[model samples]
Target: MERRTKQREVIWRTIQQAGRPLGPQEVLKLAQQRLPNLGIATVYRTLKAFLEDRRIVVVEVPGHTPKYELADLKHHHHFVCRKCDRTFDVNDCPRGIKNMAPPGFVVEEHYVALKGICPDCRNHGAGD
Candidate 1:
């Protein structure tokens, strides 16, 4: 069993409080607000341990770095802001997605990611 540390608790809380998946850098920045001396290496280490323990899950979007989120969240998809490269959880899943596959293909699993300018970017004209 891995020993719990202040750094690990802060990092875990940061990810848990965030409504969406966050990358290592994002986790570091947010965690540092409470733990001013927190480092990226510690964030990475804690994340690794969390993953190994199944306390967290990795979120991978094509062309983007992997992010992490709590493992117990309900089933959902993701939305990536093209302009800012931010990711957010899309809580609702489209119905009949598995039926889109060909007749002979078995849809054992699926992932859906929508890429577009988020409200912040769109309002700021970043997409323009």
Candidate 2:
């Protein structure tokens, strides 16, 4: 059995606790708190390995770098905060988008997003 390194353990545990998809920078920050010597490249590679093994899946954010989340996450889409630039999940698909696609295009995976002000942003009056 391969021995788990401190870096890998920190990276994995940090993201696991987040309970939400996070980008590399975010992962790096979290992991660094536990293992200050952890390098950015190391975190990137660890996430890449997890993705290859299907342990974690990528969170697709339009016009942004991809994020990572545990693969076992429930079927849900993300709600990105336009103001604070955070992301949250939505249990059900957004309203009014049916299973319609281009005539020749095959729909393999669908990602529905509701782009608007989140409660946090609304309370802070930062969403405009």
Candidate 3:
């Protein structure tokens, strides 16, 4: 287990309070609000240790950098706002998605990513 530090605690809390996955830069920016002198290198290093400890999981969206979220969240998927390029957690999963696979094919696992303008972007008239 990695020793707990203030920096690591801030980083973890940043992600936890976000209620959604956050990229390294996002984590650094949010965490810096509380720990003004926090450095990007420390954010990256802490994120690495969190991953090694299985305290977090990576959320990968096509053509975008990976983001991190807590590992203990219940099964879920993601949604990307095309206008703002922000990602949000989609807690509900469609039933029988595996049935979409061709006959005789095994569907061991899957990831669903819905893309559209989020409410904030849509309200701001950023995307149609």
Deviation in angstroms for 109 in model 2?
Answer: 4.2
Worst 10 residues of 2 by lDDT: 93-102
Q: Each model's TM-score? A: 0.90, 0.76, 0.88
Sort by lDDT, top down from the best: 3, 1, 2
lDDT of 3: 0.89
Task: Give per-residue CA lDDT, model 3, range 26-46, as digits (tens).
Answer: 999999998898888899999
User: What tens digits encode model 2's per-residue C-alpha lDDT throughout 56-91?
Assistant: 998776865677888998779887876766667778
lDDT of 1 by residue, 73-126 (tens): 988999988787789999888899999998999898889999988998878974
Q: How far is candidate 3 from the true structure (C-alpha RMSD, Å)?
A: 2.9
Candidate 2 or 1, higher lDDT: 1
What lDDT is reached at residue 46 by model 2? 92
For model 2, which pairs clash?
A: none
Backbone clash numbers for all candidates listed:
0, 0, 0
> Where does model 2 exceed 4 Å of error?
1-4, 95-109, 118-128
